[model samples]
Target: SIKLVLKMLDRQMAVIDKNIDGMLKEHFAEKLALFKDFKGVGPCMQAALMGALPELGQLTHAQIGKLVGVAPLNADSGRHKGKRITWGGRATVRTTLYMAALSAIRYNPVIKTFYERLLANGKLKKVALVACMHKMLTIMNAIVKSGIPWNPEHQNVSKNA
Candidate 1:
């Protein structure tokens, strides 16, 4: 059965669609097409990205991470463990990002290599997946904000990667 939350979101989108002015509608429709061209990115995920990062076209890497709740937070004390993962941001955004990460693992070489490396190190599946998602968000932020696309050969080399 369809969930009530999905039903509510559908109604909300209907109202918003009705209210968008003609020019903004046209503009978004056009840009949305461009977004759909990215591998594994669909309309729903693109919409989620735009909604989560409204200024996505303008955000820097760090700003984008915090917005999506993937940015690491300090969890250390005098003798505690490493940093803690953030857990209190937009849930829908994080879910969509998680899907993107899975797709990136299948189709994006750089991300795939990173994901394999995490797995090789014996990380739990979910933990490695979250790390992949964070990496995805960072790369997507740089691409969307800079009006560029993924270019493995041209990206700054990271030794840890």
Candidate 2:
């Protein structure tokens, strides 16, 4: 239901976006006006990011991953040959983040290039996409951490993940 509401809100916003030339005098007009030009990010992704991490403005990358349930958990045991990885966090958050990741690939140049490079390196299609998602979350963490909006030209240096 949350996603549904977001989708509807996005649609309404899109309609308004298409006719923004004459709606510049309303209250909070300046802030609302920015929505007319806010490309790349959409309502659903924005809502998800805000809802999934209300304190995103204060959290670190590790905390963000843990919040979204993407940080792999320990699965080692006495007889296990390898660790058993699993998804044990909020399913909805993970799904919404993944969708946001896909949209970033379409709209964000840095992410799109990284995704293409990964594909060119012979990574499996799904694997490359997930890597793109991970990188996006890391980028988001750094952006929020610095209290700055995303800048495509600024190269993100950390590859620790």
Q: Which model scores highest in TM-score?
A: 1
lDDT of 2 by residue, 23-53 (tens): 3344223333333322335555555565555
Give each model a TM-score. 0.69, 0.63
Best by lDDT: 1
Tell me the tens digit of each residue's lDDT in model 1 across 1-161.
56988999999988876655343456566445444445556555676776566766577777777778887787888888875677766788888888888887888777788889999999878888888878777766767666655557545655446
Worst 10 residues of 2 by lDDT: 30-39
In angstroms, give how far residue 148 of model 1 lies from its true place.
2.0
User: Where is model 1 poorest over a 10-residue stretch in terms of lDDT?
Assistant: 30-39
Q: How does residue 98 of candidate 1 score in lDDT?
A: 83
Candidate 1 Cα errors over 4 Å, as ranges: 1-25, 29-37, 156-161
**Residue pairs clashing, model 2:** none
